[model samples]
Target: MSLLPHLHRLPSRVILASASPRKRELLSSLLSPLPALVKGINLEIIPSTFAENLSKDGKTAAAYARLTASAKGKEVFDRCCGEKDKAVLVISADTVVESPAGDVLEKPSNKQHATSMMQQLSGEWHAVHTGVCLMLQSSSGNMIETTFSTTTKVRFAQLSPEVIDAYTDTVEPYDKAGGYGIQTAGLGGSLVEEISGCYFNVVGFPIRSFVQALIELLDKVKDKDDS
Candidate 1:
């Protein structure tokens, strides 16, 4: 059955609080299964200004990511809700790579940083976590928020210094978390020896999980309307 009708019936002003092209592409593709879903959506790509400098000390990777995502979502939700007179749904996400030794690895600060990150990941299994937040506000001023996370286990093939240098030299490693992108063809994708979970999670968003969560949230909103 087509879900577009239901999607359209809900709060139509949906916002994606991210500037990452990969995420934007993933989300647009996620809704593309339903013809015209992309066209129907009032999606606004407003990047969040939240400082993601939250300390990772004593927090699990999932918790850290989830918190960061929630903060980002809340920042955008507040801003959008203030401007729009209708109900708004804001989606935000944050992805991070956790080294085998348990250190959280975010985007590299420099070329040397990228090289070091590659060295840490080479021949080792690491966890990639993507945290998501959904903030929905009804026109009546009611607000609902949910947050969840997905983790993928990825193992990198043993890499020589030359290989690391070759990868870091390209533009692939700087913008992406973990200093690599699993979706990047030939270069970044070649780093992973194997992955134990959703491949899309490593790419930055978990579409399956997001779909399920959105359905559940929509149902709740529908019930409120019917009541």
Candidate 2:
């Protein structure tokens, strides 16, 4: 059975609650092939306002990502779920890099910081953890929320100080988690030697895991409606 048809049955306004262009493009690429099914989906892009300041204290890398993702989803869900007659579904995600030393590396603050982050990653195996959250609000105001995290083990090729310095001089590192994007065409792409898990997760969104979760969530909603 085609999943598109199952997705078409969802009578909800779908929202991508993040401003990351990578994520938006990734999702649009997924749905672009299904014109009929895409038409049926009322999709909107609304960036969440949640401060990504949650501490990773007492939490694993996956848990931290999940927590941040849930907060982002909830922020947008509360703002958009005003219409009682229409169901609303909000999707949000967060990505973080865990260094070999058990440090959670976020986007770098400056070139020096970017250089430092890249240096830490050079010739080292790091974990890229992406957390995804789905917030579903039925027409009756009942809500269902699901959050999960996936980690991709990425190993950086051995880099010299000059190589790291050259890459950090560019504008790519500041906006990306871990001061590097594995999918970037520039030096960033050359940084990674291999990854052991979902490639999309490192890019920002875990589409495969997300589709499974979305289908399962929709099934739950269908069952709830039937009952």
Candidate 3:
């Protein structure tokens, strides 16, 4: 019985392997609602140093996302998993916007590029891919790794030129994929007509899936402890 409940309050600190503020915010929000007992476990923000220059020419959205996340997780784990007394869970993620024409949209170079991306997204559906990797060093000194990806379909609501230009002028689109960020709330909600998948995936991470994986990992750790 104690083992079952122990899954909820992980002793290991959660390490977020991303420099993106949005990812940091979203991952922190997920753990914020845990019981007060687990509050003592800190969330470590460690950005991955892996270069994201992978080629997306022939890869599916999921494959690309998974590759990027896996590399990032491995990079961070190598650095932090060396000499930790408690366990460590490293979470890494990468996102890309897939256009209707089967093209991948990364962050824009400038306002003009963002505006161009917005124009292509006008009144069309695009897929948002988020590759999430979780690697953990258990309390008993066991290392585990897993990776997955989530995709959300997003449709823009026929943006006029003025609207595209206006949104691009803001600093938000410059660092976001497909010239928009759904987590931006006000600005992104206006341009989006519909979304048909995980909302947080469009932001950077997937909440539901991550929680499920974490629970599974915690249960496994508990089992190992009991043995």
Candidate 4:
């Protein structure tokens, strides 16, 4: 049985609390062998005032990712908790790029910003962190939340000004966290040196880690029911 069928067998429905196209594609691929059973809640990514604050513990990348995902999950859960559905599981995720210099690079806003980010990332190894949150509405309508995160090390080949300009001209780097998409034709194979971890994590979602986390959460929920 596929992932969706396995999930459907549970006593509730699965809800993805995000509006990202990449995440939707990843989830569809993961659930392809089963009947489509998951739904998505389109939630906006609000600018959090706390997003810019670096964690004093030095885990800035992981900390911001978790906080962002948790905020999104909670927002969606708050809106859907009163439903009569047997169970509603909401998944929210956030991804960020951390430079070796310890600076966090968010999505670029324009061509100039993209150019600047590309300059900083050129010939450097950076870390990509994605935080995932799973929130479930219990049979009794109470919400329970669990969070986990994954990090991938990525290295970019040295890029010339011409190449960066060419890439930025065609691709919409403004929508991507690092001013480049590792899955896109122009960027993935040609510009990236290598990846030390999950490739999908760099694309926007970390499917393998996410699946593991989801299964673990489900197991815990089942154990509670058994007890």
lDDT of each: 0.86, 0.85, 0.81, 0.74
Clashing pairs in 2: none
Candidate 3 on 21-79: residue-level lDDT in tens? 98888766666646665553467888899988888878987799899999998888888
* Candidate 1's TM-score: 0.92
Against the true structure, what is every candidate's RMSD? 2.1, 1.9, 2.9, 4.0
Give the clashing residue pairs of candidate 4, or none. none
Report the C-alpha lDDT of model 2 over 1-227, residue by residue, as the tens digit: 33565666555577899999999888776655567546646568999999988987899888999999999988887776655535878889999999999898989999989988988899999999999998776776666788999899999999999898889889999999999888886669888898899999989888888888888887887677668
Residue 100 in candidate 4 has what lDDT? 80
TM-score winner between candidates 2 and 3: 2
Error of 1 at 198 (Å): 0.8
Identify the candidate with maximal TM-score.
2
lDDT (Cα, tens digit) per residue for candidate 1, span 1-227: 34444565457677899999989988876554456434456467999999999998899988999999999998887776654545888899999999999888999989999999999999999999999998876766566678999999999999999999999999999999989999977999999999999999999999878887787777776677567
* Clash total of candidate 1: 0
Q: In candidate 3, which residue ranges exceed 4 Å CA deviation?
A: 1-9, 34-40, 83-86, 221-227
The ten-residue window of minimal lDDT in model 2 covers: 1-10
Question: How high is the lDDT of residue 128 in model 2?
Answer: 94
Q: How many residue pairs clash in each candidate?
A: 0, 0, 0, 0
